[model samples]
Target: MYRLTWFATNYDVNREVNNGRGPVDFKISKGSRDKTLVEFKLASNSKLKQNLKHQVGVYQAANNTSKSIKAILHFSQTEYLRVQNVLRDLGLSGRRDVVLIDASPKASASTVSDFNQKGFDF
Candidate 1:
């Protein structure tokens, strides 16, 4: 599981994610100055990450702004570094930067949480 690092940053207000076949997870904006392509991935399985990179490419094509897809960032900091390393080893550029951050405390966490369910932990 992973939580978004951007969410922890100071925010103006909560925003909505446009999921009409766009490349990233959600649209995060910094005031009116910048926008980002935030792609969240928890299970960096060989198959899943490979597909995500492709999705990043498509995501770039979908956006009409000049800001660029900021990053194809995976937020599973505690345990997925190896997989992230492998993905970086491939050298597929253009908005790919795997990030690591302590997982966010879930609003409603199960006492016995798996910590790998794909969101709310990173």
Candidate 2:
């Protein structure tokens, strides 16, 4: 997993190798005093959402961050725009200093349309 604090003079960035099904990315803390959680997926997978939910919920609770822990889903291309949309609507888009990066411009737009048309919950 990778851990990094952004927009700071000093930060922590750690990349941990995955052993099985686990995270490989990092999330900036809601505040230096608060806790953060993150997950990175290079490919689009339906199970990613479930992982997101758990991270934002159970994981946050476990960490005891009442200020709403941050989350980042690093995708390589259109494979993850679906998740980005949900994050955007929730005001978690990169424009808001939440989202991390885009997988691909083409796939990003297509993923949005595809998700909307197929009624998939990104």
User: Clashing residue pairs in candidate 2, if any?
Assistant: 1-16, 76-103, 77-103, 77-104, 78-107
lDDT of 2 at 21: 37
Candidate 2: Cα lDDT at 63: 45
RMSD of 1: 9.7
Maximum-TM-score candidate? 1
lDDT of 1 by residue, 1-122 (tens): 22345456764322334445543555556665565555555544446557555765565456533333323334455345655565566664333354443353545755746776655456
> TM-score for every candidate vs. truth?
0.45, 0.41
Q: Give the whole-model CA lDDT for all candidates, comma-separated.
A: 0.50, 0.48
Clashes of each: 2, 5
Instruction: Itemize residue pairs with steric clashes in candidate 1.
Output: 2-121, 103-122
Model 1 ranges with Cα > 4 A deviation: 1-16, 30-33, 44-46, 65-81, 92-96, 102-122
Candidate 1: global Cα-lDDT?
Answer: 0.50
How big is the positional error of residue 3 in model 2, measured in Å on the Cα after superposition? 4.8
